[model samples]
Target: MNSYFVTATGTDIGKTFCTAGLLRANPTLSAIKPLLSGYEEEQAESSDSGQLLAAMGREATGANISAITPWRYKAPLSPDMAAAREGQSIDYAALLGFCRAELAKGPTLIEGAGGAAVPLTPTKLTVDWIADLGLPVLLVTGSYLGGISHCITTAEFLLRRHISIHAVLLNESPQAPVPEAQTQATLERYLPCRIFPVRRDAGAEDFRTLAL
Candidate 1:
């Protein structure tokens, strides 16, 4: 089965949205957010974990959500800081093992938290985790004012490390200075890869072109 590590330019930038769309389009595709920060059990249905559950046609119950996303933190911060707040730390080996096992189950979409540089532990950045997994990335970025620079910088960092980027999803951000098309064009110019524009409030059909 094919597996992809879904990462993004920053937190709340549409990694989950892009992933949910793909999952909805292909119902058989399994997925896991694996690690999450800023999770509240009371508002389970509104969180990213809940959204993913809905997309997968699973009930948004605590047990169901936890099955896919095990590492959850209540604080809205990077995993390193959030884990520190709870007097815990992520075991990199365990995290890698969990993802490998999940990927082996089927065509899984493994989603990540925060930005590429955001630390999962004291010394392990998100990029390091992606590198260790050795999976192609479904890179997601926003179409905000400084989107071009952020996309280019993150793209360069991954490409320099020889990470295969399966595709780039330019998720539309609200009240942006320019249209999403402009952002996609700029990224295409700098990045030698396929870039897809995901409009604001896009649905599952909007992402079918990716052939998920």
Candidate 2:
């Protein structure tokens, strides 16, 4: 089973949009937001995984959503801290098992919350989990203001850690100061990896542009 994990430099980047793009490209694919903290009932209206399911035309059924994601936290913070606040703890093995199960189903897209090095457990880093899952990664970086440096630094860190990045998605958030096309050009000029800029309103066809 082919799998890709989408991670970014920070929160509020277009990781969800990029994930939706991938799902749109391959409707049969399954996705995982294994640990979704910061989940509020009101915010479910704008939740990442929810939007991804919608983009893929899948109903948020119990079986489908549960099969893809096993953990859901309501605190708007990193998993470790959020779990602490809620008197809960994250199980790494359980998360790995869910990811393995989803990958077994078909080509799966695993979306990482926050950035690469955010804490999953007190001692374990998110990138360590990414290493454990051992899937090729796709980075979704915001391409405005301070994007170029962030993308390059992230790419360098991934390289240093020996993670295989399939490509980089230069996402233009709705309120980005600069136009996406221009940022795309600038990113292409500096970054060595393949960069694809996704629009704020991108759908399936836009996602299909990535060869996975």
List the candidates' TM-scores in order. 0.97, 0.91
lDDT of 1: 0.89
Question: What TM-score does prediction 1 earn?
Answer: 0.97
Q: After superposition, how far is residue 131 of candidate 2 from its true place, in Å?
A: 0.9
Which candidate number maximizes lDDT?
1
Tens-digit per-residue lDDT, 1-212, candidate 1: 37899999888899998999999878889889888899999998988889999899898898998889989999999987898899999998899999999988889999999888898877788889999989998899999988889988998999888899989999999998987787788889889878999987888788888865
Q: Which stretches of candidate 2 lie over 4 Å from their true place?
A: 42-45, 175-177
Which window of 10 residues has the lowest lDDT sum in candidate 1? 203-212
Spell out the clash pairs found in candidate 1.
none
Tens-place lDDT digits, model 2, residues 1-212: 36899899888887887888788788777677887888764555467767777766876665656555677788889989888898999998988887888788888889998988889897888898888988888998986788777888888888778899888888886667778788888878876678887877787788777786
C-alpha positional error of residue 140 in candidate 2 after TM-score superposition, expressed in Å: 0.3
Each candidate: what lDDT?
0.89, 0.81
